[model samples]
Target: MNTYTRTHLAFSMLLSIAGLSLPLGAQAADRMAGKMDTDGDGKVSAAEHAVAAKAMFERMDADKDGYVTAAEMDASHAAMKKDGQATDSPMSSADKIKAVDRDGDGKISATEHEAGSKSMFGKMDGDMDGYVTAAEMEAGHKATMGGKK
Candidate 1:
């Protein structure tokens, strides 16, 4: 092949790979939004987000102890990774627990989780429209990750 043709091919391949990687974060956000959009509305209403958060709390409370320890959160993240779900959270499990561990209990109670989820929903709503679209969700995730991937 001519040098110019080879260079063009390499550039095209690089672009293709970059494009594929670029959507991973967006895709992860879309998947999360889809899961929380139980009503098939293509967006997560406040109620839907609450329900999803409750369900998540239940899942994370593996011992049914009404609280999620950092260990539990880590285990949940591990399970998500094992199941092929994207668990690329920027915060560690301990950091997550600390963020919402109201009263400094070193763990997350259901009430705390609910409160945190509510706060997160409010932030992710962006326009204060009482619903979170996929775009908003992606933006929120990015913001939570400090605008990192």
Candidate 2:
């Protein structure tokens, strides 16, 4: 292969590996997507999305607007860190908040929230059951903790 082809192949491999390194919580949304999507539907309906979206919207939407601003994202990150939930990991809470705040508005919108949640859930839903049951949670917790319950 030519030099360009070899470099592209190497870069592709690195990108693939980078995608595989997301942390436990980061995959939770994909799992929830399967769960909230009742009737085996390919996509999550507004109602189904709303069920799971409410609590998160409330938490992330610091201003109570129908939207999430970038400031809210920072505030959430600060609060989580203050509660001893901070982490230096690549997929830490702060990282997630910053990543999801697309507009740098300090908060995430329903669409962004849904996408992020689905991504995290997908990683955690080991059984593909469309929801994270107690057993699944236990298993994920165990896996993350080196098999310690």
Candidate 3:
């Protein structure tokens, strides 16, 4: 198989191991925050959030090309679905990439991903604290989902 196929398979396996099968909603956000809580302190610190974002970017960069194209993002979401994981987000792959695609490249560079992730972290940190609680994460998720439950 090609690198893309292999990467998708690997990501699917990881999803299976993690048993992540929820849509991108409040529940998923809470679970994601819980996983990012490396210290198990009932919240996610900025460092922990950054680590998670980097890992996610690596996984989405299926070709290891240091950038994530819309096709790669779609493939990653497909892999998640194949693994019984639900990535039900309102934004399309292209739209997601566009949201963070600096320079209008239609792809996400590592720097762009980090900047977007940092911005998201700031949004999720409701109280302007350096950490995000599950409740805050849920609220942020809902807001991003346009208040969808």
**Each model's backbone clash number:** 0, 28, 0
Q: Which ten residues in a row have the lowest lDDT in candidate 3?
A: 12-21
Off by over 4 Å in 2: 1-50, 69-94, 102-106, 141-149
Candidate 3 on 1-149: residue-level lDDT in tens?
Answer: 56544333333222221223244455676777788899999898989988887887888899999998878877877887788665554556776666566578878788877876776677668899799887877666545444555
Ranking by lDDT: 3, 1, 2
Judge candidate 3 against the unseen true structure and give its global Cα lDDT, from 0 to 1: 0.66
Error of 3 at 19 (Å): 13
- RMSD of every candidate to native, in Å, equals 13.6, 10.3, 9.2
lDDT tens per residue, model 1, 1-149: 56544333322221111111123367766777787789888998999988877877888799999998878877876776688663344445665666566578888788877876776677668899899888887675454434556
Q: Which is the leading candidate under lDDT?
A: 3
Q: Rate the local accuracy (lDDT) of all candidates.
A: 0.64, 0.46, 0.66
TM-score of each: 0.80, 0.43, 0.80
Which residues of candidate 1, in runs, are more than 4 Å off?
1-24
Model 2, position 146, has a per-residue lDDT of 44
- Model 3 pairs in collision: none
Clashes of 3: 0
lDDT of 2 by residue, 89-135 (tens): 23333334455554666545677666654554454467676655434
Number of the candidate with higher TM-score, 2 or 3: 3
